[model samples]
Target: MARSPQRLSGTPDDQTSPIPGRVTAPALRRGLDILELFLDSSEGLRVPEMTAALGIPRASTHELVGALVDRGYLQPKPGSAGQFVLGVKTFQLGGAYERSLDIVEAGREAARAVAAECGETVQIVVRDERVVVYIVRIDSTHSVRLVSDVGSRLPAHCTAGGKVLLASLSPEELATLFPDDTSLLPMTTRSIDTVERLNRELAETRERGWGEEYCESNQDVACVAAPVRNPRGECVAAMSISIPTIRWQDDKRADYVALVSTGARELSTRLGARL
Candidate 1:
């Protein structure tokens, strides 16, 4: 007996065929393609440029760009109509990726070692706009530990780590991070309250390649910090040791500085920094 021809389940172009793996999402791919186009253009990009370069339909490009702008991945350039640039959230995501690097784990280990050696509180922080966020911390071996903990944020001007990270920024970048001088509120009487004073402090920090805070954030607390750089020699984080005023010795400042600076350098080296 002859068998009849087996008819297909659906149509020849059935998209819902039982595929074993995940399928490609055209919209997502298109969005990613649009984003990658900006990698070659640092200044700004226009929808027409994307459409012309990527061979995407003008309407689709407009919709995609609009969606990205609404989602904070792309932003309109100031004073340049129809021009787009990467948004703050994009920069934030890049920073997040940088912090998630294996070197951050090394930094954590270094922080613990430094705390054990100095018998003091240790912290590793990164700047987020005008604030410094503590990402890693190790408490002092002594009963009197510092009040700071991981995830705590403080004004960049009143903390040693904050100053160190701030010192890494260029003048224009620093100005953009701090446009309104009045936003620099004083955390304490000793805290830097003016851009001029903060500039001087940052200058000193850059000169020393380290930063210090003496009774700025807290009267009884003091800190010293050193830069932790990335492979490109950019300061990506700051490592600091905090001590109580009672335990702080004028002569021992150099020793504390050496301890933190060494730890930061070692961590930076692990992160592929030159020095």
Candidate 2:
């Protein structure tokens, strides 16, 4: 009689069974695990310490560390033997990753979301010396709205977004920008026209974590803005919402402030900021 074929035993989910077409390298996995251990370690780690932390064989840990050192992914700590830290290669990779982030696109999405929430015109701007340059704008659905467009430049002391950006600068930097305590140019009668007054408003902006302009940039327009920060916690831009003066309500100022602040925080988060 013909013999029956042998039967396979374990299910695909069994630990001992290898899945079909699934490629894995134990050595590479172990090597990566070793690198990850250093993330939580402030000081350099020795091969033995890594081996203990990762539960890899001491010999394997040595081999992996040697390979990483040779590849410039790790380097020996200064004046320390057999202890390694992340290498210059990691810094280079980090810079590349940061450079790859596109602030304009991120701001555009953030502006759209905020505009949708508040039903007002939203804008994103960056500081240019004593001025703020608009980079993104989302128009309000209302028939009447602020008409500022992308690429438009405005006095830093006269607009909410501009004030927010200016507030991010140091006192010395502000002094350098203004150069003197002379009165600034006015966009309208309500605009802040003196360095002293602008400084006071900027202080208020910093204290409240947002900025506001009432008939400053335009007689018939008012605005609120908040700062957008990057991963390094540096203010990179300002996000603002403009309201027609006729529609502006003092009672609703708090609501506008909350909306613009939330939008700025969202944009900051998208830029990799922790908060």
Candidate 3:
């Protein structure tokens, strides 16, 4: 057997080291560096401008720029050939990150207050494609409570929070998410099982300004949810209160709706939404 080559170690930043301690991809680092250059510039940059600023060859700069544009991290400036700016995908990523931070802080406070008042489990969720992902959960004081934890993903058509988030989407967007031939999967017998029914429920949810589900996601649970809007009035998340079916009274449905809606409004306000 041949002996393995001896390793040479040095600090990652040591310029004179033959082999640095940390490994990195030069192209990736350079691509990021190019993006950072935009921080100091309000106007878009051309290939030549980026090359001069990064002190790299023009061909390398062009390749990086093309890759970024292809991945939607950058876009050509409107009416300006060869000039590029950060793309909508970049804004979306930044916004999602910022909203997540705000949601965790504001959502917890709102959910705590609601759970305390109603003695029911409260949760905050955001839509990811066709599913709703739980981001915040406040367990009920009762011994029997919802078992779904943070990061759980559920069908968007099977839960109150999911419905509320779905209701926020435009008709065209909804159509795209659920094509005519698509089947709506169910977690329980009571769950919505058809795209048509889901659409009708979403319409009602929009009309009533909230969403409600009974024995849908869980055969023994009922839930009510309202949309949490951002400063721009966009529904960024849904806040919900879940109750065990044994404790879910039809007479108290209005009260449950009111409480969850109020909780959602409070969370939205905390996130700088006007309403």
TM-scores across all candidates? 0.63, 0.74, 0.64
**lDDT measured at residue 28 in model 3 versus the true structure, 0 to 100:** 70
Candidate 1 collision pairs:
none
lDDT (10s digit) by residue, model 1, range 1-275? 11112222332223342455654455666677778676657788888888777666899989989999999999999999999998887778768766777855787898988988999999999988989899998889899878877788999989999999999999998898777678798888898888888899999999988999999999899999999999668999999999999899989999999999999998888776766
Query: Candidate 3: which stretches are off by over 4 Å?
Result: 1-101
Error of 2 at 77 (Å): 4.1
Judging by TM-score against the true structure, name the best candidate. Answer: 2
- After aligning candidate 3 to the native by TM-score, how far in Å is the CA of 85 from where it should be? 27
Clashing pairs in model 2?
A: none
How accurate locally is residue 187 in candidate 2, as Cα lDDT from 0 to 100? Answer: 90
lDDT of every predicted structure (CA atoms): 0.85, 0.85, 0.85
TM-score of 2: 0.74
Number of backbone clashes in candidate 3: 0
By TM-score, is 1 or 2 better? Answer: 2
